[model samples]
Target: MADEINRAPAKVQSALLEAMQERQITIGDTTFKLEEPFLVMATQNPVEQEGTYPLPEAQLDRFLMHVLVDYPDADAEHSILRIVRHEQRAKQQSAPVAQSLVTQAQIFAARQEVLDLHMETVVENYIVELVMATRNPKAVDPELADWLEYGASPRGTIALDICARSHAYLQGKAFVTPDDVQAVAFDALRHRLVLSFEAEAAGVTTDDVIERLLSRVATV
Candidate 1:
């Protein structure tokens, strides 16, 4: 896990870019391939925080999803406290830790299953339209034209398709639907967009633009 990644300098971020995009790393004289199902879990403070740097667009594009983590509710916080207490007690007693029930192979299989989930032609077009709207916002609505300085790249298209399929699969569905696309759209596309200065000055957020995109774009 890359904890507090925004604390890292530009050079380190560049190295991570190669690993994330090519699934390989280059050392002094040799390159190494990352193992299958390689995943990167990174955390960062908001850019407004002290000593934090904003991530470059290329590096940001490499990330599949950018989820905002809010404070947990009271019930969840209570559970977290209990978990910490249990861990402390276990450590004090020198008790053996429990093994994870999930296996690596199971995770690989689940990923494959998600990829194999059916998505119809119409649904595929819908995903494309959503991404396209980001590129040419004026056609969708005049206000969006002023709000966006830049839109999601082709990677966003692929991310949307796969993420929608995964969402459906997790819901025990055999096929993808428009609702699945909408469900994952905010997390998948929010970071990819570059909002205009005008939008920011007006207090327009990426989520607000995304909500507009979802409302204006037709399924068919």
Candidate 2:
């Protein structure tokens, strides 16, 4: 279900990622298919990078997103403590089965609804332009010329479109907008970019460049 991939060696990581992409594993004489709704959520501990090998760009592209999470705030921490204490106290009594918010069938159906959500022509163009800018940042923003070594692949373009649709669905909206695209651009594109030495020497992050691109890319 979940793997702490940082503990694995480079060869292991490559094999695991290959499985994630193909949704199947092959042995000497036979192959097996992964079950439906099969998802592999991988995370690495942020503390150290001692013996682990970093994933390459091609392998990273197989993932749909790369979200960054931070420590919970005081309120959240307090809530977590309360939940733990409550769970401990409740162990003496029989607990009912937890209800799922949405089922697999519902999710499959919702995927269609999300696809049906209207995206105007201009907004679709905006999504393309945003990814296109990554390839030729200097054309729109001169400063970005020295910041990037290479741009995202065509996978980034498709990611921007579907992710925006999902964002709109989460918002209870029936349409997609530039704002929806903007909401997901960072997570969808951050891992796909390769920055240059000039950008690294100045402590520039992919987020910084993406933020600038979002601001400068034209919507109309």
lDDT of each: 0.95, 0.87
Prediction 1 TM-score vs. true: 0.96
- The number of the candidate with the highest TM-score is 1
Error of 2 at 113 (Å): 1.0
Per-residue lDDT over 87-119 for candidate 1, one digit per residue giving the tens place of the 0 to 100 score: 899899997768999888999999999999999
Candidate 2 TM-score over all chains jointly: 0.89
lDDT of 2 by residue, 9-115 (tens): 77776777768888887776788888777767888656355765567777778778888878999999999999998897787676756889989998789888999
Colliding pairs, model 1: none
The superposed Cα distance between candidate 2 and the true structure at residue 8, in angstroms, equals 1.9
Against the true structure, whose lDDT is highest?
Answer: 1
lDDT, residue 34, candidate 2: 81
